[model samples]
Target: MNTTPLVQGYEVVIGFETHAQLCTRSKIFSRASTAFGAAPNTQACAVDLALPGTLPVMNHQAVVCAIRLGLALGARIAPVSVFARKNYFYPDLPKGYQISQFELPVVQGGVVEFFLGNEKKSVRLVRAHLEEDAGKSLHEDFFGQSGIDLNRAGTPLLEIVTEPDMRSSEEAVAYARELHKIVTWIGICDGNMQEGSFRCDANVSVRQPGQALGTRREIKNLNSFKFMQQAIDYEIRWQIAQIEDGHPIRQATVLFDPDSGETRAMRTKEDAADYRYFPDPDLPPLYISDQMVQEQRALMVELPRSMAARFVAQYGLPEYDAATLTQSQAMAAYFEAVAGGCGQPKLASNWIMGEFSRRLNADGIGVAQAPVAPAQLAALIARICDATISNNAARQVFDALWADPAGEVDAIIDAKGLRQMNDSSALEQIIDAVLAANADHVAQLRAGKDKAFHALVGQVMKASKGQANPQQARDLLRVKLQ
Candidate 1:
């Protein structure tokens, strides 16, 4: 837990409630399509619109998504879970209630672990329940009246609730990012925050160390990480200032205005009892068989943590390098292929983390979209390792390779004349010629000025037109000095 305050005299406590829209093709309780950007109310069907004589039916895929999440987080998957109707009145909710899991959620009690700088932090999860999203209220395109968009109505969503274990916004963002990776990695959710595929709600409070928990206000619909952090920091400062001025901190729901960089109250926060949650009469209890869990387990891919550990143990990589490389599956696979192809794990790690990553970020693309192939990278590393090219020449070759991805690696080096001059006799001749011209430097080197020797090496490099093997030239210079 990060208990230290960004400002003095108060501790900021935070918890997150994230809603991840499942990747299923249909809504949770209806056959309506779950696609985005459709015309309003076009996708909503009879069940989604709560038409007369309609009863809710469970989508088995949503249940599988919840189960996969539980297994991924190491949570307890309830064999049988009840669905309930959370009574609430809003213009967007056609049924005036949301079908959700309340008392017996599908997943219970897990921890999400991630790194904040060098510190490893774990945030405990209270529960993750399956629910259906309500329609959208559009306040645009109508004069003095709002329109409702039912396209997103009844979309399958997994609402993940966390314990109030985060003490800072950074920690909360880390947890959200880690959870996003897990959901996307397992093919459950798209994890696109911009399109409302993944949404976050942060509950923020402040108190002195060892003091009783303070009243928390829930910041709703934080769709981006940057906005989430800004909202939490602003809310924490606001609450502390209120307390300092002897005003009570009221619990309410607030929204973050990205333009203003501030939070404003929307409504008073409601306790669970205020919602009147009870088992839905239409939907029966959700039951999961052991066989179904095993089936999903068989379909599960190797997780990032497990793959990172394998990278460390098998390739002799540092923990940090391994962890960084395994941020995405494509990057990890590319790294392994490059390392194995060249039989140089350390060099492969360096290039991937440094030049390749820099280029990826510059191009605003992921590793999967990288232009350079693993074999090409391996060949480039081989040249550098065998002294066929200097590090500078290797970078030139990398640029050439990236510019012309289909171009041959050796052809590029040969065409540019970037190969290092490795002939020992030729290098020694160059060194001797430079030494003969710079007698003062030689005398200064013999008189114990190490810098003069470096000056002589620079002359050798210049004479050879930057192609002289640096180590070979240095060795010849040292021998002549001796």
Candidate 2:
């Protein structure tokens, strides 16, 4: 087992239950539109409303979504999976029962690999089952009464469950991000957390060393990554405090209050028996052939891990660089363009991961919205590699390109007078002048004082107005001193 992260002498164990809304045109069972932002109750069809004489029909596209996710995660797709009706009562659930895969889920036994900073980590998935989403309850707007929004009703969902493998909140969030990237990259889901397209339920608990597993409380519907970390951290601390006191941690469902940064129990958590799961008599068992799996596999784009491995092997990138670049398909493609254009894969990796990322974060924009095109960055990098400009000068060129993305790098370099002085004789003239003017510093250098050499180089650069290539100046100064 991996080393468990401890909080106040207690080991924290975290697992995740992520619901990915399948990208389809209609509801899972009904033929109603699944588009978002529709008026409440406008999108719900008679079947979704659980009207009498309604027989549920399975959505084939939803099954395809499940198979794609399975292949992406290297999981097994069962030949046949059954749908069960989970008996539950809620204002939003117009059917009074939810159709879900319980006894036999479609996708089974997968691992989601990611990194927490530079440490590679992976979480084993128990299963990912197909299900339909319940409606939404409007508690914020109505006056003292809750309203139902059935627009989300019957939307296809794949509920992915993970084992208790994450030892910290950071690992859990990283795993979630990787899963999100895979789903969005493959076009299975939009991955819009704000729109409720993808959400996580974190099961957090703490136990003493060498003791049995502790009771876990499920934090439900964490919509934001920031809030997910805060809620888990708070829950871990709370559980430790309760154990330190005389109180035992109870199993319950909780909610995170971002305003106060705390978790409060909403209700007692229920086990499988509480739901009274039974095979749905209305729907037959779902069957998948070998041909269907192969078709879905062929349709998938190059998966993130495979792309990352290719970057490491083909581009000579560090594992970290490959992983960072392959965070999204767009990012990886942007990097490949820059690398191919510059023919300097390492330099391309450095700029994209460093200055480019910094600028994007500062502007609150994504990689797609970057003003500096890959070709422009590649040109800048090529200039640096060819000794036409120093790293600092290349940054100046980057700034110019950012301001006017249409500006050519060579034009900007000439316009700003930022090109390095690479001519050896002209540089030799500046070196001679600096040597003649700074005899005292030169004497210190011959006496083996390394600082004097740098001082003379600074003088040469100053005399040339910062255009003199510092390395060439150093080379010329060494020869002159000899």
Candidate 3:
């Protein structure tokens, strides 16, 4: 088994606290818009501004979104849960206290399964609860003061906490990506890292196999997968180094510097006592009924694991290809669309994974924004399979189709006169011309030089203007040589 020295005599235990912003039109307690990038405080309302006499009104949409997520994670929705006030003093928190769940949360006890390398591993989830997000403090203009943006304040957030199950940074990142996919697939969250819809806080600690847990450090505000991996890797090594040097690990919050590629301590970790969490008197305890849970469960879609299996069994795709294609819902739908007709599954996968993905990356487009439509790509692949056009000609047609989605594949073939020269008589003429031109290669083929056959195929393809089907051209060349 591949193992890390950091966990050689010790077990590296990890848990994640992921905050996913709900896809709601307004803030959790106010009618203020929750849209991103609105000139800082333009989306803020009087309630979000923490004006006097403004009482918090819970958003039902936020509660439903949280319940949907809990059902998707296979968690138990509590009959009644209370929102507690987590008191803290920060410029971003205008209310001087943030509304969150303590002691009793809305949902509890679930598990998420993901693959580590080729092995399937399961991570237990402790709880997932509803909370309001704090505003952002922009430090861009440091004239000795920071700008406060309450646009994000009071936004509905679902804090999903996992049990200490991950061992390496790779596993942690994979788990996070899977969770991201689930949320986005269900339409609960947009999963936009750049806009901070989904944020991760990782708790990392190392312990001897049979010993108690070590001091765990919280790495906060990790937005991207690459940064998460790097930050955890660096933290693991730093902790290992500290233990090796006779220094004890400190429990604190740390921030990762992408440029420095290291994590630095931000503040001492706060205990529950520090937050002084207490049930809010303004709002009553939230309740979930069985009918509500059943309704949410009915809306859940087939998850990645189930879809992966279907891709393998029904589509006859390889395990890796199925896993990759099913990673994103858009990609999976695109694949199904392309493979809808009588197209060969393996060939469809090759074209989609190879040429399709290449073009997407080259053009800086996501699958959702791909210029080439599924039917257009499928028609192009059909033309190649039926020998109406060579693979190279089909690729050229695909490029044109990508540029112009309304452009028809058959129209492009007819317009460019790119049809494959598959007629036996026509191919024989080109084969004879090529053989006559390269007399030496023909001689080599007769002298048991099998490699010379490839040279002849190239010459014939060149003579036919790359229209001849390569396999047919080779067969015709072999017949003529014999």
- In the range 46-138, model 1's lDDT, one tens digit per residue, is 999999999988999999999999998999999999999999999999999999999999999998877777677898999999999999998
lDDT of 3: 0.88
Each model's total of backbone clashes: 0, 0, 0
Evaluate model 1: give its TM-score. Answer: 0.95
- Residue-level lDDT of model 2, residues 10-91, one tens digit each, is 8888999999999999999989999999888999999999999998999999999999999999999999999999999999
Number of the predicted model whose lDDT against the real structure is largest: 2
Model 3 alpha-carbon drift over 4 Å, by segment: 1-11, 49-53, 115-121, 207-211, 442-449
- Candidate 1 overall Cα lDDT vs. reference? 0.91
Q: Would you list the clashing residue pairs of candidate 3?
A: none
Kindly indicate the candidate among 1 and 3 with the higher TM-score.
1
Better structure of 1 and 3 per lDDT:
1
TM-score of each: 0.95, 0.96, 0.91
lDDT at position 225, candidate 2: 96
**Prediction 2 global C-alpha lDDT:** 0.93
User: Best candidate, TM-score-wise?
Assistant: 2
lDDT of 3 at 140: 66
